[model samples]
Target: MTLLYIHIPFCDSKCHYCSFNSYVDKFELKSAYMEALKLQLQADLGRFEIGPGDILSVFIGGGTPSTIDPALYEPIFKELWPYLQKGAEITTEANPNSATSSWLCGMKALGVNRISFGVQSFFDDKLKLLGRAHRAKDAIDAVENAKNAGFERISVDLIYATSLDTPKRVEAEIAMAHKLPITHLSAYELIIEEGTPFEKSPNVKKESIEQSRRVIQSAKDAGLEQYEISNFGDPCRHNVGYWEYRPYLGIGSGAVGRIEKERHYPHGILEEYIENPHFKKIETLTDEEILEEKIFLGLRSDVGVDEKILPAQMLQRAYLLAKEGKLRTREGGFYNPDYLLSDEIALFMLG
Candidate 1:
């Protein structure tokens, strides 16, 4: 079963740490972008040979999907309905400030069953530091409103380990998040991506392992299981599709798609994509590259790589690593306990 990811590249405001291909001044391009995106999706559906009952999940992520008018999503959903499975988990990432009750209800009516809020923190000061458009109360209201609007599966994102963040702060955030009707939580450590505002900001600090562990323990205490390094709870199926190396389609500017061993990337610039929906760059991955990805991606989540896929020598190394307590074996595959060392373990086993 294949997965679909649609990227919305519009945002009301750009966050300090975000380097995503999103724009705050491009509000005028929204309608044109949506039309172009739908066209691309329609063309891709035919090109990929996607038919009725072939898709397992759909994720609409963005610069801030909530900022867009939900009515514009109808056409795309109508086109996708025939291909979606009976109980496909369709999700949309929304911002607290813009994910109004109306937007929530509209998306739900359009087949979106899950809503992931970009609630980086439940503190006004932290929100300000992160350049978030929403306040602490806005996040609470958004979740409550989403629940009231009949959303069952809900997720919230948390950013920890910023200079303004502390162990107490993370614990408090987890406590508050647990109190919400959220089923999943993606607690991430703040990373300063180069070329972003945070990269040159002295306020951004390096995250410590101990700080992360404390935050993780708090999430676990709040009933969210650490299924992946940064993700917790039952896990997002669409994201899991990526971790398991399943072929998926990506639509919109700067989006990447992978079908079998072939990968496709539409133009990174929004204007270029709008001019020609087929302005895509494609690459076929080598077997070695695919294998390395399998190991790397598999180790980062609940689904570990099958031992059968490894060479005999690599399998022996995996066993040795398991013995040393770096990795754990279960269900006929090796799993890493400390996801931070996943790269090191994968490389060591590869050697």
Candidate 2:
């Protein structure tokens, strides 16, 4: 019941709203990085004594993993291929501009089953404003290439905020997404992360709450249902493990893994290569903490907490919300509201 994540910390360029631990340079060290990752995996398995179990999922996220030549990926895949069982989910994050026909086909042949593209916006203006290197056309082309190459599960990541983002714009974006051959969609609200250029811009959407709601409604209309507060997909299996708080492993530079015994594993640097991979920290969530997390995350999805186990206080809150026509019980649990931003108001009200 563990998940493995590999973080490729190199990218061709950094986006304006990005706060993740990724950089635009140091891809030259990818070969060394791969060697270190292999050593790290071997050492980790030894320390953990992970049995010959299914590799539940492998996620290779990046500054830009697609930018690295597939030849460098060969060794890592060779070592990992042995551990994979049938139905194991493997996902990679690729930038639209970096994705091409050849790259998609090569990874698929190697059993890479899923791809999540970074397609922030369809409008060229939004793309430029976000500092994305790919235009909407590139996104269209990438998804088509992936489908033609036999990828069955594809997810696209989008961002919303700023002056140009309106309910109409959000609807339009989702409408455009419907034309593409993708199975999943993960849309996020704009957050002015620290040290990013957007933090200094006065044009940032401080009060775009209404606009956010419209955007989400647009997505639902397109049949991309909301599974979590920020993420939307089929929803993808990777997200199920994540939202359900299932166990997983994290590898590569700056990657984080939460294992048993309250331990976390991280690959510290993209600059230096190591024969053996190690972690910077392992965080433990207390019993109370895990309970709280379940409530927080569960409430964000369309299917909220099971009524049987829901806290008495939460049930009371739900009662009040239902009375107000803001919450409704369904087959799984409870739905907050039909609107997109309802989750936010629900969280605040319930909190």
Candidate 3:
């Protein structure tokens, strides 16, 4: 089966810790950028036409997709809605600051069924530290508005590792996330990317994985099952495609397609993506690589994997980790119960 992704590259303000293919040109460039995207999509349609066995999952990801002028949406939706599969999963990535009830209503009217809100933190001070534009109140209010606008499936995002982000604080965020109406939560640790402004700053990478583990466990304690290293949900669909090694097509700037993907990189995903939209350096994986990825991704999830598919070496290590309660295996393969500890375990195993 095949899936689709559409990247949206606009944010109300640049976060101090972001290094994606986004610009601060919010005024003059917004309209023109949308036009450019339309041109690109028009030029790309022939090569990516729909076929049988396709599962359409259009994700409007971003610098911040919700910040875009809603005016740009209708024309594109009109042009492309004809080809969508009957039970398609159409989602949009939105920042809390831009997710107003009217905006969500318009999106629902235009066929968006899923909404993923970028709510880095529910504490005002932590929000400021992450350079987020919205207050915690805005996030709570946005989710409420999204529900009122008829969104049946909603996802929320949280950043785990940050200064002042104690295990207790992370646990508190988990408690808050559980109480909210969102069905999915992508709770990720803050990693400082090279060349991002925060990378040069001293405190951006201050939190440890050991401390973060407590917070992730706190989420599990709150009923949000860890489905992947950074994602959690019930009946997760979008991310499962990635972990389970399903085919997908990604469009727009900085997005990567895995319909046919190579494990090795071209050093810079953004540079190559802008220069060549063929998912430059893309390769259809060999069976071996696909199997390796399946074990790797499954081990990171609470769902675990099938025993026969796991490599012998990975199985041995999984047993050792399981004895320590760091990982567990059932009739299925293995899973990192405290997935927040996964990074350190991977590093140690690799070393």
Best-fitting candidate, scored by TM-score:
1
lDDT of 2 at 238: 65
Ten-residue stretch with the least lDDT total in model 2: 271-280
Q: For candidate 2, lDDT tens digit of each residue in 1-351?
A: 667787777778889888787767766677788778777777776676666655777888876779876777787888776676568898988999988899998888878899999998999999998989989999999999999999999988888876677777788888888789888888787788899888888476544666667766776778777667666557667667766677667777677676643647564656543534664566777865665565565667654656655567867876777787777778746665554545564565456
- 117-233 in candidate 1: lDDT tens per residue? 999999999899899988999999999999999999999999988887778888999999999999999999888888988878846765898988898799899889898889988
Which should have the higher TM-score, number 2 or number 3? Answer: 2
Q: Please, what are the lDDT tens digits per residue for candidate 3 over residues 1-351?
A: 566667777677888778777655644556655665565555545555655435556778877788776778877777567656777788898988888888899899989899999998999998898888999999999998999889989888998788778767888888898788989888887888888778878585667757666765776787776667777777456667666666666666656666554432221333334444443455668876776566566657655556676567755766777788877667666666666566566544333
lDDT of each: 0.90, 0.75, 0.72
Error of 3 at 180 (Å): 2.6
Candidate 1: where are CA atoms >4 Å away?
Answer: none
TM-score of each: 0.97, 0.88, 0.82
User: What is the lDDT for 63 in model 1?
Assistant: 82
